[model samples]
Target: MSAPAKASADPAAPGERQGTRRRRHKGIAGNALWFWIFVGPFVVGLLIFSYLPIIWSLVLSFFEAYNTATPSKFVGLRNYVDMLTDHNFLSSLGTFTIFAVFIVPLTFVLALALALLVNQVKIARAFFRSVFFLPTACSYVVASLIWKLSIFNGVRFGLANTVLGWFGIENIAWLSTVDPPWYWIPLVTVRLWLQLGFYMILFIAGLQRISPTLYEAAYVDGAKPGWQVFRYITLPQLRATSVAVLILNLIAAYQAFDEFYNLVGNVNYARPPLVYLYSISLGSIQDLGHGSAGALILAVIIMIVTLLQNRIFGFGKAGD
Candidate 1:
């Protein structure tokens, strides 16, 4: 009889247990309130600033938004379709593609080499690193202005022309010359000089992460002085960092504007898409719709390139 009564009482015990659970539920709700209070500012800011702006941009891309006195007009995909047929848009893409083809690989290789050399040095390492990175601290406009007026200036007053005179050669027009001679040489030179140090720092950090013991093991296996352990050990270990540096270089090369703007101004010979967009909207004519259309097209291209790179190189993968 006592065992049967105890068994029957067990079913009623849940009611008391339910009261305990209700207390715990109230406590959890209070804790959640406090957590939200602490984090609410950041959440609100992101929603208002970042997300809202993105929504606005997407909306504006569908309509003709002007910076001038004209009223906004709904043009759907007219801007996008016009972009496909625009010769200047095609030229800009072609120009940037060519620039990236040369610049990206060159930047990566040179930066890696610089990092290796700097890492191996025992003395004045800090000084050399600072010297290399100094160019990055300078504004692109300042560097471009100096290069335009002093270094690669086409005038007899320029340092380059002065040097050529020493070899009994006539002072040549450096900037005005069409392609292989004028535009690319100085552009590539300045671009490399400015960007190399930043990428070198990234590579140096990657190199430091590699274990010295691995290098020692390779050396024990009779790895020669000039022959690198990079093929087997260093590269595999630093694959993530290499992919990161490549992606960053790709984005920078595509969005390049300040250097080209200051050096070449409105000159189409070396104009990148961003520069051309600026020329159309802000500089020459107040064609805001065209500029926005160009900008949106560029955004799409960047997105596509990023996706392709991620797929090909597994860029988003961590060390695992």
Candidate 2:
């Protein structure tokens, strides 16, 4: 049939193909430009503020530096040695350990409990959530002041003492009572109040993610409605969130400063590592090398603890 009438060359097809390639090229270029535009500032800021400071501190830690201006001498490991041998540093570590031990479990339990309770509420859920979370909006410094001046003030008229007075107990020095560390009342309470809602929100988000079908299945299997459902279904399902909350609480506890600083106001007994470092570096002494060394040491301790916690929780496992 005349070679199929000499099949007509389709000029439109080639044009369409070229147009598609050009569109794709433009799309890729636009995406790359936008990605850099969005991420460039954050990357630059992180390097300038976070990574640079960490590197500079590490370098300073190895020398006898003062005020980060310059190294007075090449002390090698002397700064680390001094920090390790210093009694005050050791005491701060012990204090932080105790605080973390108490605060971590307490915050985890209380936050989970509150989350469960709030999740169960049939009415006014948003109101209750806001009420619980409002305190977190307050600055730590302001909350510490409120706790110190209004609640746990050493005076007879303070709220805590006034309540005790109603119970026929005399006013007590809540902050100054180092004999039994009654300062922990304000310190721990403020921290709990400031932090509990945040963790509770985490748990609530986690709880919402759990499949309702799992609870139904449990119920059909004769699991009871309340704690049984939670124990068998909710708690097990919340492993990741729980681990995160616990680790965060642990780190916060170890780094505690504002509450203690404001409530105790420079007392020596209950200082955490940050406060100790501050006293040495910027406080009266101004020893930048030892401060940097202590900070690095504390950072190592926190990292170790976090890794151990992650291991215990089996984080990064396939199913987890």
Candidate 3:
């Protein structure tokens, strides 16, 4: 046994394994370096532009930062107290609540109707989709302006008044009269026009995701063509999509500023939370502290509402 020279058991094996490991380590390091190189700037920018501003705003909210962004004259929770107690702000919220109640359902139903109708069309489907979706590309500001100046300018020449004139009705001041709150008509319509198309697209996507086999099975079970199938199958299938649309609609209703601001202008009755906060921040008050406090409060309210909606709808659950 001692005479048998021990064969060097793959003498290069250990060195080759070590070299492979070195190469792997170098490759890993290179990938890591490249990742950081690409991602570092975005991270830095987010901290600087988004997070820092929020932190600064929070800090300013604690102080008397009137007409300025910098924190000055620490007043603790005075800004929050004043904002919460402000009658005008509370009234605006009340009005907004009524508006939300009206708009959310209207938009949901209209969009769903449009989606169902569009989904039924076997020919020129893309053309219809594009036609419906074109409004979503429109600027809210531009839409507001058109609705304000051309459609419902509270003048005899305005489109709405002109339509009424043809109907043997008097040319009514739509925006100018707060007594009837007729401004809501244009506000609601413009928002519907701008939003309905986008939501229709969402519904269309949801509709497409429904398996045709389900419909076939329903038909086999003697389900009717329209109402019965829709009530029993289509609607239930679109539950998640409905929840999402409702949530988005509610939030958008709350954030309605451009239309209110452009159309209603300084009308105490029509100012939503954003418009009210805008006035507080940029108006004669110029109270940055109060504006920041209001914004934070609105954000908290929106978050709570969104959570409640998710809980009620079981948004992310498998069954939902």
On a 0 to 100 scale, what is the lDDT of residue 107 in model 2?
Answer: 92
Local distance difference test scores for all models: 0.82, 0.87, 0.89
lDDT of 1 at 65: 62
Off by over 4 Å in 3: 1-23, 33-42, 318-320
User: Which digits, one per residue and each the tens of the lDDT, describe model 3 over residues 166-195?
Assistant: 999988888877778788898899999999
For model 1, state the Cα shift of residue 119 in Å.
0.3
Candidate 1 weakest ten by summed lDDT = 62-71
Clash count, candidate 1? 0
Model 1, position 310, has a per-residue lDDT of 90
- Tens digits of per-residue lDDT, candidate 2, 50-102, equal 99989988988988877664776888999999999999999999988888878
| Best candidate according to TM-score | 2
Task: Give per-candidate clash totals.
Answer: 0, 0, 0
Task: State how far residue 194 of model 1 sits from its true place (Å).
Answer: 1.4
Best by lDDT: 3
